[model samples]
Target: MRFSRVVEASGAVAATRSRTRKTAELGGLLDDATAEEIPTVVAWLSGVIPQGRLGVGWRSLTSLTPTPSESPSLTVAGVDDLFVRLAAAGGPGSVALRQGLLTELFGSATESEQDFLRRLMTGELRQGALAGVMVDAIAKASGQPLDLVRRAHMLTGSLPETASLAVHGGAQALAGVGLQVGRAVAPMLATPADSLADAVAALGPDLVVDFKLDGARIQVHRRDDEIAVYTRSLRDITAAVPDLVEVVRGLPCRTVILDGETLTLDADGRPRPFQDTMSRFGSSGELADDPNGLLRPFFFDCLHLDGIDLIDRPLSERLAALTTVAPGMRIPSVTNPTVAEAERHFDAALAAGHEGVMVKSLAGPYAAGRRGKAWQKVKPVHTIDLVVLGAEWGSGRRTGFLSNLHLGARDPDGGPPIMVGKTFKGLTDALLQWQTDEFGRHETHRDGHTVYLRPEIVVEIELDGVQRSSRYPGGVALRFARVVRYRPDKTVDEADTIDAIRALLP
Candidate 1:
């Protein structure tokens, strides 16, 4: 198909507010695409390349303002090949090569196509239809069950390939996609409950309350001597932590995909700060040679063991299978505890310097990537990780420091974050100094006392509750919001979203 068709469909999808209309538009595009073009079409609509980052910067795209053609001439295959070349161009004089290719590609595109390409290349395509909506569109177009497609997408961890399968091979093809040992399935998520008593009342007496550690969520996959560890976002970090690889290798099974948390602990066996855990994943992680700095894994749920996939089984069955393999590494939990017993357990977890307790339903299937009432997390305070949109300058005692942070919740649609509220309430002098130094590096614009940021920082905020509001794009505001700690471990994508914030509304 011609690339203009996609540009037009993108514009139509963005223009409509109705979910039905957006799905229909996206379905129409998918219906018209061939089997070979499905990957490119899906990737473009999702606002990413199949090859991942191509090292193309905003300057490279904006500087070359080439003239556009009167009509569309580029095919989907031609555009896909150009991106492949762009990703391949690197090291020594590759800059000019990328520029020449982009120039030619843009010069051949129409005005509308050029605009779409610019947004797609720069990762700024804010179309209302994100991955969730696009999955619905694919299901709509292919006449398949939404749940089946969603599960396939989640397990495969590739919407582009899922689209191709649904389009060409139908529901039977989707049924074939299962949890692979080496590949990371999207982790099952939990929704916040009012309290432990409320969660027990709702989820029933057979609840298993496990300690929720304030550490990095890691999904470890081991096959023979080889092992791969992925973060919440499914980015591989096997190269950084060799010690973790050795730990998972000791499991009884030859092939196992285990989901759990990893953290560095003090000499007393208390968990360290989350920042220290995350430091072992990013840059400078390989050089971290502290004797106490070990990412201890506690297998909470095993998705796959040996040659069998356990995701289809209930939590009870999954836990049983986990016991057969790595019983000692399993997260500590109490089953069907009374109110007093649960409280004692919660207090014990707190005393151990952990975050809180995660109460889970024993009958629940894996339910990968779905956050519902099936699992409930209870923290000491109503704390959530929010993205920092901007901050204001401090005055008097706190002069020359960044204060009064503008906080936002992540949007579900992958657009700009929704502004819920702002807070400078719980920040200390040390935090103020840190924010002043770090935030300026991400500053986009500064006006008067406020300096706007690129929404890259995630800060943990404690709020009383949410109230309906006239201000804020989310149509709700956080009440009694205060800073807890800066969540350097979280990305803008991992922070609590606007929809999650609204769930606490009174």
Candidate 2:
């Protein structure tokens, strides 16, 4: 298929607010795609690259200003092949090789295609073609069940592969996708509840309340002695987390898949700041021996234990299996607690230096990769991760630093990040200097007062709540939002969505 067709579909998807319209536009595009072109098309429309990061930052892309072609002739395969070559270019002279390839690709693209390529290469392609809508599109195009397509995508954790399967092998092939011992599946996520009482009321008394630690989410897979640890985004950090590997390996089960969190604890056994844990978790090499820096694993759910797959089973059954195998590593929890008892547990968790308590329904099955209402998190303060859109230059006492931050939330429909609010509060002098230096590296353009940036940095913001506003694109603005911390462990994709921000509205 032609690259222009995909670009047109993306534009169409972004131009509409109705999800059905967006799905229809994408479905039509997918229907015309050849089997060989399905993966690339699906990945692009889903706002990602099959080759992952190509190391092509905004600076490199902005340096090249190729004139647009008059007519469209570029094919999806041709563009994908160039991206592959660009991703592979990494040596003494690889920079220039990548530059040459990009220039060639962009030079052949038309004006609209050039804009699409620019946004895509910089991870700013927000065309409402998110994974959920694309899954529907795949089903619509291939005449398969939406449940089957969604299950295949969840099990494989690759939308492109799922799209290919739906288009080629049909429902039977999608049904064949199952949990693999060595592979990482998307971890189930929790929705937010206003309070512990609210959660108890919503989920009823048959609930399991566990302490929600302020740490990184990990999914561990063990087959005999071999062990693998993956982040919530499914990135493998097994080699960097050997301590965790040994812990999982010590389990009695021959084959198991466990979901949990990992973090370093202080001398007093309290969890340290999240940055310290992520620094070690995101490392590429073996870490030095540090007593406080050693990452410890805490299991919460068992997806697969021995020969039994517990994902389809209720949470009560899965928790039983998890306790049988990794009893000591289980997160501290209370089951079937009354509302008053759950409140006490929440208080205890807060007093113990944890973020909050997770109130989970006992009868809900593991809804992997989906943030359903079966699990709810209640915290004392509202904290959210948002993208750093731009920063204003400081004045007076804060002069010479980037003081005020422009924040944005991810659009659930896959459009560009929606500006929610800005804040100059909660920033220390040290943080000011750090952001000034850091934001410069990501600078796309600058005005007299602010430096606009690429939507790559994720910062955690603390807010009183959200209020409806006409100033922001999402029709809601954060109230008294302040910086909590910079989340280096998260990506724009993982940042809280506008729908989440809207949920906070009063």
Candidate 3:
């Protein structure tokens, strides 16, 4: 397939707001892709690179102004080959080599293709070809069940691989994909409930309510003596989290996959600030030197145990398995609680310096990678993590500071961040200075009053609610939004989606 075909499909997907139209366009593109070309095509359309980051930055892209070719001649394989070489170019003079390669590749493309390549390389491809849409597209192209494709995607945690399987091998191949004890599967997610009572009402009385700690999500995979720790995004941080590794290594079961949260706690046994936890979590050094910064793992769900896969099992059975293996490390929870009892549990979690409570149905299976109502979270305050889109200059007491922030919610369909609202509230003087210094590092452009930024910074915002409006692209506006704190622990991909914000409408 020609690279131009992909560029055209991406453009068509971006030009339409209707998800049906976008899925059709992507499915058509997939229908034209060869089996060998499926993986690369799927990854590109999903706004990611198969080779990961190539050390290319926005500055490098802006520095080159190559004159595009008159015709489209670049093949998909040829472009992928260039990316491979770019990823391999390193050591001395590697910068120049990479620039030369990028220039050569861009110079061989037409104007539209150059734009596509630039956006693709810079992680700015904001088409609507998200993982879910792509899964549907794969199902459409391969004539397979959507559930089979989605299940394969969840189990494998790789869209490109799932696409290839669905396209080449069909439903039989997809059905064969299962939970591997050593490999990390996508973690199950929870939906936000309006309140504890509402959550209990939705999931019924036969549910377990556990504390929702404000910490990083982790999946521990233990196969005999080998233990690996992975984040929610599936990045391996086994070396960085030795304490967690040791804890999992001590579990009774030899082959087990545990889903849990890891956080740094103070001497009084209260959870520390999220930033402190991430600071230690992201470090690759030996944490034994700092006793106060050690992370403690709190296992909540057992996905597999003793050579048995329990993802298809009920939550009650999984909890029973977890209790048998690591009862001391299990999160505090109460099973079959009434609405009032669940309310008390929610209060207790907040009192313990945690975020809120997670109400889970006892009979629901571990629906990995899907945020269904089987698990619901209820918090006392309404808070969301949004991306920093831009900021306006401040005046008066906050002179010279980038005070008023432009906040945006993630588009669940993988389009660009949708603007929901703006706020200068809840920012302290120290925070103002920090934003001024940090926003400068991520600046993409500047106008007379505001400095636009790349959507790289995630900020937790507390809002009273949301109101329907036409002022923003999301067709809603935030009500009394205030900055809670900057969430360095989160990426833009983890930010709250526009659909979530809209769900707050009264």
Candidate 4:
């Protein structure tokens, strides 16, 4: 297949906003691909170039790159290849090559489309595009139902498997199996709930509440004595976490998959910052001598045990099976009738210095890759519903127009506006301009569309924690927060209160 075909498919996928349409188009492309060519094609399409991960990456910025005279054949390369190329072509010449590639093929694309391509190369396609969206596109192309494709994805770790299944067994084969939990399996992202009360209420009476630890979610897979620990995104960290490997190696079951979090606990047994735990993932040095460096696996859910698949099993059954394989790490359950008892558990978790707790519905089967109301999280931090007042222009591609935002909360006491923290992390270029214009129209004043807002619009904002700051009027500041979304339904007066902010402070 020609590179142009992949480019065309990319364009088609980019042009369509609907996930279903994108999935169908990608599916069609996959179906047409020859059986022998599937892996290579998948490799090419997924941009699995030689260097490692994909594309001309950030690492390329510091290194040297190939000259025009030495331009290698563009047959097919993985992410690692492009990244290395970019690294080698470190100066203006390499940048020109990347820009040339985007402009050469995707030049016909709309400005937004082109921006999307660039973002894709940079490894930040923040239009909320995910692997699942592409799965949907592949499903449509293969004439499979979207749900079937999604389920197949839960079963098979690779998109190529989904493609092969669709080509052979059709949609029916895709939907035949559900997600298997515990046996150290990967899970889809969990939707966060505000509190245990909120989670239990959403999940209902028959629920399991687990300690939401300060750690990283890990999928442990054991086949015989060999064990592999993969992060949620499937990055293998088995070698880096030697302790985890040893722990799993000692499991009772011969073959199993378990879902749990791994953390570095302080001497007092309190959870540490995520960075500390994540450091163990791929450290260049030897494992920390501290047993605290050990990845204490807490088995909350089980997908498989021995050779049997437990995807169809209820949460209760799965939990029971989970305990049999790994007893110490079993996530504790609370069956108190009232919400108040759950609150006591939440308080206990907080007292233990954990981030919060997770409440899972006991009767539901594990919904892999699904962010339904099945699991909920409760945190103590106060999330503000503020408005985007104005923005500063960003650098590089966002050279002009509003980039970072001036978010504010309406004074409940009818006082002047309170300035919260600013962030440039979440906004896409398109989102930047859209906000600029939107905030500009509601602009009380404007300096080239870096307009101040009416404070009428409200947005939900999440922060890691609150810190004391004299820089802003609220005497408190948001720590590392980005926009969740615009809460259009909320009015200025309806925003969270100062008391709420105080409650969130450390």
lDDT of 1 by residue, 442-475 (tens): 7778998999987778999988999999899899
Computed on alpha carbons, the lDDT of every model, listed in order, comes to 0.86, 0.90, 0.90, 0.64
TM-score per candidate, chains pooled? 0.93, 0.94, 0.96, 0.64
Please give, for residues 395-501, the per-residue lDDT of candidate 3 as tens digits: 99998999999999998877789999999999899889999998998999999999999898999999999999999989999999999878775678889999889
Give the clash count for each candidate: 0, 1, 0, 40
Off by over 4 Å in 4: 20-129, 169-185, 382-506
Regions of candidate 1 where Cα sits further than 4 Å from its true position? 284-287, 396-401, 428-443, 486-494
Name every residue pair that clashes in candidate 3. none
Candidate 2 lowest-lDDT run of ten = 281-290
How many backbone clashes can be found in candidate 1?
A: 0
**For residues 194-230, what per-residue lDDT tens digits would candidate 4 score against the true structure?**
6656777788788877777767788888888878887
Q: In lDDT terms, how accurate is model 2?
A: 0.90
Q: Write the per-residue lDDT of candidate 2 for residues 353-462, one digit (tens) a residue.
A: 99999999999999988988999999899899999999999899998999999999998777679999999999988789889888988888998999999888999999
Candidate 2: stretches off by over 4 Å: 90-93
TM-score of 2: 0.94
* Model 2 lDDT, residue 344, Cα: 93
**Arranged by TM-score, best first:** 3, 2, 1, 4
